[model samples]
Target: MSLTGGSVSVRHPAQHRGRSRLSPQAYLATTGRILRQLLADHRSVAMILVVPSLIITLMYFMFQNAPHRPGAPSPFNNACLIMLGVFPLIVMFLITSITMQRERVSGTLERILTTPLRRLDLLAAYGTAFSIAAAAQATLACVVSYWFLGLYTEGSPVLVFLIAIINAVLGVGLGLLCSAFARTEFQAVQFMPVVIAPQLLLCGIIVPRDLLPDWLQWISNVLPASYALEALQEVGAYPEPTFVAVRDIAVVVGFAVLALCLAAATLRRRTP
Candidate 1:
């Protein structure tokens, strides 16, 4: 970047043959900057830390009076376990996407890219910061559900919290990828219905995958959210994480990694 008269222009980073090496200093600096920005926003902080718990609390009451089958878990308990994963994914997706989009619109991302920061460095920084926020968000939601809201799972609450954190990180990855296609914050908001809602309906939270039509089942099989819901369901049914549950957790992690790679591939030093 240079100044000519009163105008300043950014010189885009030259294309490299392969992925740029991530620098420790650049990664830490970028991560610190993004973390600072996130902490500076009170609204984002509230949404991240409180919204999932609030939603779970509301669901608890809404189903409080519903009938319970004699031998099976109450509907509220089942739904609460599944939602513990979903809410984080949805909330983080929205926050991360919008925040990244804001950085792009403000030219902060471009300026940073023009420096020694590789795309991977910037993305990893965003991931690390959001992952920390996600851990807190998942922890609060799990604590409230198990202790305050009377949610119970056959498996350990620790497993449930871990799944929720993974789901939240998955959200962060998808959000970053979506932000690349959105020119404005409102456009990023519009992506929730397109990207998240379908997953919600199809993830076996609303209806069991076995009960769905064969084609819908096939589609659900391909969505990352389905694996998350399945993992939670396994945890609910078993006292320990089963082989299926472990496999499902691995699938969610793989999908999150894929989304992050795609997001990095989509990054541009300058929007055109």
Candidate 2:
């Protein structure tokens, strides 16, 4: 972006190897770099991640002495599953916004734009990084919850791992779409409420759809979490819940693909 250095020559396709296709290895490498960046960024790691863990802890204490039914199931497992959908939204948004916005302002994104590397690959890298970060955080949270709050699950850890990974990946793809559309870092931050807050309120988290009005229930049904929550709960609380949870996993994969297309469309646009 600096004109004082005279003309800048962008590298051609043959000049670079990793940018041409969406390589999972390349994506994982970029994700490692991004994690190093996060470790260096201690403040962000605390606010977006540590704070949520603290919030969960506080909620547990506040509800500790409450009444319990004779035959009621522990809702914590499913609640954690519900939290997976919304919590990753924040983490993914933070990850994508920080990295992409920095690149955009520093001209790194501009340089990459002229290359053979597809925008989808670029976005996929961010999502990959976020997915890894989310997994680590979820593991930490699960450990803390089990040790301190007596959290237990009747479901398989393998299933939980799958759900967490898919949820994180899908969330990161969504965050990329949000970051791509944002004109500025502040705008990206602003987009969070519009993008994620709705899902938190309506995705069978706070208020169930059946309790809401007919139109509102219909609206909530369209949310990604509507399907995801069912899958998560089925794996946790209601092991025999209707519909195949594996199919919901498929839906999460579909969302990731769809979000990749949105990212591609975003980078493809011209100033006109």
Candidate 3:
């Protein structure tokens, strides 16, 4: 086609095609591939699901003899809540970021992008696959905490399990986002200190937010883990769900969605 006077320009048919809509089949295929890879890696499977439970059990025994007032909150309960909220975040973050970095380095992601796969489909597939593992991990942690460790909760154990899963998913989202910036597995692992350590310090896990300085408290309020820990605490302390508990859950979910969207947007088809 003549553009102006003597210049001829042509548009490729592929360029004319609009953005591909997400396909469930493609998403499931990607998810299944990831799940199969994870299953084959026996070490990863144990690290993702089993190690956290073992750690929680150790904590239970360590705190079993701690002194507590008759009406005061139990140290064991607080430790269990912290384990549920933080353990999955740490494990899932390491797994997702390192796995994604490996894919990027191996040119697998570039090859996948050459196909008709949408970025959102890939991101959702990672999220879904890790979420399944996350759910299993959370379940194991909760069961061991409740049965073996003798964790007593005023609220439903089901609620604790649900919140723990959400927290794990949040880690997956953050891991994906962080992976875009990492060129090596070491860099991905380094993100734990830079991205997650601060949250752990400020998320009321080690020290209660109320006891923190005003500025630190403000920082804590913005961190998603803070809300997760808060929700778990509420569930342990209250017989019925309270408004604060629901609100904290919503905030944690919102953070997870926001992180995932950022991850999809920032993902590159190939490493530079």
Best by TM-score: 3
What Cα-based lDDT does every candidate model obtain? Answer: 0.89, 0.68, 0.90
Sort every candidate by TM-score, greatest first. Answer: 3, 1, 2
lDDT of 3 by residue, 140-189 (tens): 89888888888888999999999988988999999999999988889989
lDDT of the structure predicted as candidate 1? 0.89
lDDT of 1 by residue, 1-272 (tens): 45666767644346452345767887888888888999999999999998878988999999999998898798889889878888889989999999998998888988887776778768888999999999999889888999898888899989999999999999999999999999899999999999999999998877888999999999999999999999998999999789999999999999999999999999875455
Worst 10 residues of 1 by lDDT: 10-19
For model 1, what is the alpha-carbon lDDT of residue 197? 96
Displacement of residue 205 (Cα, Å) in model 2 is 1.7
Q: Write the per-residue lDDT of candidate 2 for residues 1-272, one digit (tens) a residue.
A: 34785977777546675446656666666667777887788886775568667766876776676666766755554455566555665676666765677767767777766655567776766666677677777776666666677766666655666676676677777777777777677877887789777877787777776798898888887777666776777777544533667788787778877876887688633221
lDDT of 3 at 39: 97
Off by over 4 Å in 3: 1-13, 16-18
Model 2 RMSD vs true structure: 6.7
Better of 1 and 2 by TM-score: 1
